[model samples]
Target chain A: MTNSNSFPAIDQDGYLLSRTDWNPAIARQLAQAEHIELTANHWEIIELVQEFYREFELSPASRALVRYTQQKLGNDKGRSIYLMGLFAPHPALLVSKIAGLPRPANCF
Target chain B: MKSLLCISRHSPYGTAIAREALEAVLAAAAFEQNIALLLMDDGVWQLKDQQQPIAGIQKSLARNLNALEMFGVDTVYAHQPSAQKRGLNTAELCIESIEWLDDDQVRQLISNHDHLLSF
Candidate 1:
């Protein structure tokens, strides 16, 4: 277990080495690594991705993430453009990263 | 689109094959292929309701299976005799729209698909 002072160990690719090592602080640190400043919008998607991991036991692929977001957050917040604006260039992978979840297995 | 069928014969959680099969199906569906899934033998256990995978050790196969329709893999089948032998009722399945088929129908299903992927 990592102490509260130091950051948790992450994989070579910057994902948390252990899901248990994650917390809000860790999420903030992770977002920093991705050069993202966490906002209410970011937190909302991050929380949604974490919930998606909890329910599905796996990270959502890009398409699945879009559909899931649409289902839960409605068409307005669910579109690719919306998710991209928050976590662009690969929202599924990037969101999962900031959310402290594993890189989506089906993403690549 | 060419029709593809994925046949899963392993029990979920015993190994990763069951999950792999499901992933393949979902991937194919995502690509807009005409795909169907068949859960036979111990694979029928995948559909059994109330799956509680040990937290952090495994993921809930039932919940993952529930996402089939959302992924566009709408045609899912379960072997009726396999479920009966295991004492699983249709009502107890995690996914509600799964079509149950017997031996002869299973044969027909096999012959109907253009390609068969067995896991």
Candidate 2:
């Protein structure tokens, strides 16, 4: 079963379980896969994923995930360009992979 | 090639966001780019069987979705959870039935696509 504390720390075998355990190695992998360099915004998204998991028992949907960040960082920071820059696909999926929860449904 | 993915997460008449998203999708399709539309969360209500626009407040968006196929935009998907949340069934909606996608699937779709433009 999935829970708030399910995600493993950045160390250990967390990377195998969840992409959110992004260490330098995993970050490099993500950067290569998405064909873009990692930036602070990317880290911000990963951090937001962790924060979201702590708040909502379940992983957020794409919109909720964005709104959650908007509520936290203000509207300017919550824009899709900024959010998308961090999570190539959708914020929820990116966060879920990192949060160690099952990917969100309906993002496609 | 540029591909546009439009994700709608609000209900019609509930807010202007939903209508705006639909309009954006239509506009993208008009540009002759590959476009896919995903309706999730409260956005699924836009596809509900019968949607009556609240008087003169706004126009019903159901027809716009129904016309997607004619515009050469056939890919439409809705989250199963969203559908169940509002007790919506595919048959009730006028648009073509969409395959329900899970989180992992959605992730893969987004990653594989060239450009994802969500509304």
Candidate 3:
């Protein structure tokens, strides 16, 4: 397991300070910090958000996150409840943090 | 919800205004507000498909605009004369479903919105 010191710099909210520092290993560690375990379903959404960041060069707010997921992953996996079940409390914020994306601009 | 019309009148990468305008539209849409984008003046350059910003220096504005629809910003109006004056080819636009408007139509479009934000 990667030690706490082995992780890259993060913000107060635990999001990676630099997107380049993100990797599957770092993502797994970040998810662990949020008390989430890595599952294939979680990885799907994680990779999708990272792809979203790469395409738009901006982190998505909740609405955009759901819509983008729907566009890419189909409705079964794109609903807010589905996402909230995976990341709970606040899906957009938590998912972005775990994916090493900057805090979503319109998350609040 | 009040309808907002965001007019983007600057070229992408020339300054931050164009991108800022786009962000405001997206932000409003994220809030579930009804928002539309109007690209006029130099803003027509934002839809030009052939953009490759310096990797670390600037993000691609066209790519940013692509997310507008997904963000619930479905209406995108482009000023035809501004595009013509700048010699932007329709074939070169990166986005689809652009509502092209002449000057009179643009004025009418301006009148149709409950709020107007110019960039």
Residue A108 lDDT in candidate 3: 76
Candidate-wise lDDT, in order:
0.86, 0.64, 0.89
Question: Which candidate achieves the best DockQ against the true structure?
Answer: 3
Which stretches of candidate 3 lie above 4 Å from their native place? A1-5
Worst 10 residues of 1 chain A by lDDT: A99-108
Rank by lDDT, descending? 3, 1, 2
- Please identify which of the two predictions, 1 or 2, would achieve the higher DockQ against the true structure: 1
Docking class of 2: incorrect
Task: Compose the digit string of candidate 2's lDDT tens values, residues B3-68.
Answer: 777888887875689878876776666555687888888888887866666644555577557645
Model 1: per-residue lDDT, tens digit, A1-108? 566788888787788878888788888888787788899999998999888877777778778888889999999998989998988678888888878888876565
Q: TM-score ranking from best to worst?
A: 3, 1, 2
Q: Using TM-score as the measure, which candidate wins?
A: 3
- Candidate 1 per-residue lDDT, tens place, B92-113, comes to 7787888999999999999999
Candidate 3 docking: what grade? medium
DockQ of each: 0.43, 0.01, 0.74
Residue-by-residue lDDT tens digits, candidate 3, A11-33 = 88888888888888888888888
lDDT of 2 by residue, A12-94 (tens): 32233544444555555545555656677666766676665543333455655666677778898777677776666655566
